[model samples]
Target chain A: MFLNLIRWFRGFVVFEIMGRFPERFINLSTRQGHFVLFSRPRKDNFTAALLLCDYRTIRPIARKSGVRLKVRERHGLPFLLGKYKARCGLLIGLLLFLIITVFMQSFVWTIEFSGLTTISQSTLKEALAEEGVFVGAFKPTLDLSAVQRKIMKNIDEVGWMSVNIIGTKAEVEVKEKELKPHILEANVPCNIKAGMDGLILSMNTKYGKAVVSSGSAVIKGSLLVSAVVENPSGDVSIVHADAKVMAQTQRTKSFVLERKGVFDKPTDEASRYRLRAFWLEFPITATSVKQSYTSRFETKSVFLNNTEMPISVTVEHCSRFSPNIYSLSQSEAQGIFAVEDYLYRLFSLSECESINAQRHYAETDSFYSMDVLYECEEDIAVYENLVVN
Target chain B: MNRKKIKSEQDKQNNSFGFNIKDAFSLKPRIEIFDNTSAVIDGSCGVLEYSETVIRVSLGELSLKLCGRGLTLKCISPTSLIVGGFIKSVEYIM
Candidate 1:
């Protein structure tokens, strides 16, 4: 394939050598140390293809050997390009296409990430973009090892990483750092106390002496189990306390909701397109919205033969809309309150054996106020480190 | 001028490198054929005849004839020639 390309680049001609003895012409042409591509004997004449320069040099040799050389065909790059001299635009367009293809290869189009969990893809992309390895980034100017080091430095969660560039695509592989668990020291003396103010419902004492019984009201920091263990033989010892103290608790919260607000509704969307060639991105057209508008950016990458191209299309869609005033209806306010009340039940009162809730709402001319109360039974066991005095 | 004196004189002029010492100090022409497909002739003076199936080269004392199908002269330098085709046979004419 490359040989034909090279042959075309250097123009060649096919000549028909006809005379008394074509062999003499062929021999005399080569006897001067000139190379002929090929010479085949026909019925009466021999046809040989030679470089155009060689053909010009061998004209006298043909005459001296009594053979007349008639050029049968002219081919190669110069002749092919000369045929289209009249069409200047096509030639210019071809040149431009070649330049664009070369330029597009110098940018990174698609970035692929693998071996990431717990850590987000956007976080790593941000870190990589800071280190010059993002989409539309110039590929040639990137220092891959430096990019890896910077990314590792920027994100503490990423323990190790590598950046590999294959054509227009950048492949990023990462291993996330594992967090070590905090474990309390064993055989340490401790005490169990009430983490919140609640009435004691039950007790499960595993170690130490129980200080509070069922149905006893206790406040925060009130010890339910003591680490001082007294033996029947009149000997006392300190031990690590372990206990589960179930309690009934009550919680109250309030929220204020505004009565008036404005929200936007998208009316008409206009898009601005940009052509991205590697590191260069230029707008094809600009769109201006007089009203308030929100923009959404999207990049469409081009691929050839499963390999990504650095060329891409960036579209910024502008949704032109203005905010309209609307007051929150009573039912909408109630809906918001119901949602908040449900969250409270799900998060605050979670794992409770039994729960009772009361909701109150007070409305003024300007805003609405919601008060939520939750009554529930849960474990309020808290471990307190013993102070050695 | 007896036969023995003539033999002794010819022996004195014999060349160790030239194969054709009898041809009066003429070096031997070398013809190499490759798998009946191509032929290379060294020490050839010029081409005498050319055709699609036959090519005759002059080697000072004899003409090196090549018989083949679709024969073509791949190279024809002053002292060497290369023939490319399906070569049927090669002959050296005295």
Candidate 2:
């Protein structure tokens, strides 16, 4: 194999000598410091052999030996090139394609970001693009550590990030920051005042003196706990007032429901299509209808041999919906249930201790009123800075 | 007696160099046969006769005839030739 490679590199010719005493020709050639490989007799006097020499050297030898050397085959790079010399454009194109392929392999063709929840992919991609770490960017020019530092500094939500460039794909993995819960501290001297008018159910004072006991009916903004205290020797001191006061409160609300209303109903009409391309998107199907529609998009990237490529396909499902007018009669409207739902919403909106009793009064055929008595617990302290006069 | 004495004096003079004159200058051909199937002859002059069963190569003062079945000249250079086949015998003729 090694000898054949050398022979192919230097270029050789396999020819046959058809003349008188071809054996003499071979002898003369070998005797004059020429290489004759695989020399065998053909028909009567004709001998076929492979000469491991240039054609220029063999021409003179064949002429001097008075033998006709017909080249039956030529093998080597130069001979092969000469044979395809007429189609030079095709050769150049093939060479150019190889060069372009090697050059394109040095760029990032696909960028994939994972482990993102609160932070959007587009925002991270934009940040990466600013650092010269996006698709079509040169791989060697990207400083991953610098890019990571820049992303961590620019995006406050990002806690950690890792940028890994494998071949033509860039994989960015990230973790987001977790938010801590807020805690409110009472450090200033203040009085605990009534947040609403209610009958006091219970009072538990951690600090300061309780001025109002249980079963005391107080108005809004009335002090329930005092921050100032007096000793037996006429000495006074101010302390931060802290207490939990449970109270019973009353609430009344009215809700009116109409006999008819308009509602949007989803129909079974939906259109789905796919778009596929490399680094560019071209929708293969027509656009969905211009009506109001809710759409869902799913994208899948193409990978060849476990390596992600720039080509991807996106499928879109668009569902159109129209409004439907629904009506209900007086008896079928279920006004009590609607009022109860409204009361539940109102109670959820306000902080309360507990509801004691609920009463509903039907004022008219279309009007319904509800009265809810709630037992609540709240902090009613208000602070006024000490006026030094 | 004169010729034998002259040849003995020449042999003594040649051995004075501590090596055989033909081996020191590589003036003689070296033939190596392997299991009667392949033969390599170095310092060959040229081909004398070539056929399917016999190949005669000239090596200066001596000639080597390779007798084999389906004999072929695998390689031939200026001073060496490699013959491969089912070789039967190699005869040296002066």
lDDT of 2 by residue, A248-270 (tens): 76655444554566887776555
For every candidate, what is the interface RMSD in angstroms? 1.8, 1.6
Model 2 misplaced regions, further than 4 Å: A9-12, A31-34, A41-57, A70-93, A140-143, A178-308, A312-389, B1-24
- The prediction achieving the highest DockQ against the true structure is 1
Q: Chain B TM-score, candidate 2?
A: 0.73
TM-score of chain A for each candidate? Answer: 0.67, 0.57
RMSD of 2: 7.6
Q: Which clashing pairs does model 1 show?
A: none
DockQ of each candidate, alpha-carbon based: 0.51, 0.50
- Assess candidate 1 and give its lDDT: 0.85
lDDT of 2: 0.76
- Candidate 2: residue pairs that collide: A193-A380, A353-A376, A354-A375
Q: Among these predicted structures, which one has the highest TM-score? A: 1
lDDT of each: 0.85, 0.76
lDDT of 1 by residue, A47-72 (tens): 88888778879988888989898999
Q: Positional deviation of A206 in candidate 1, in angstroms?
A: 4.0
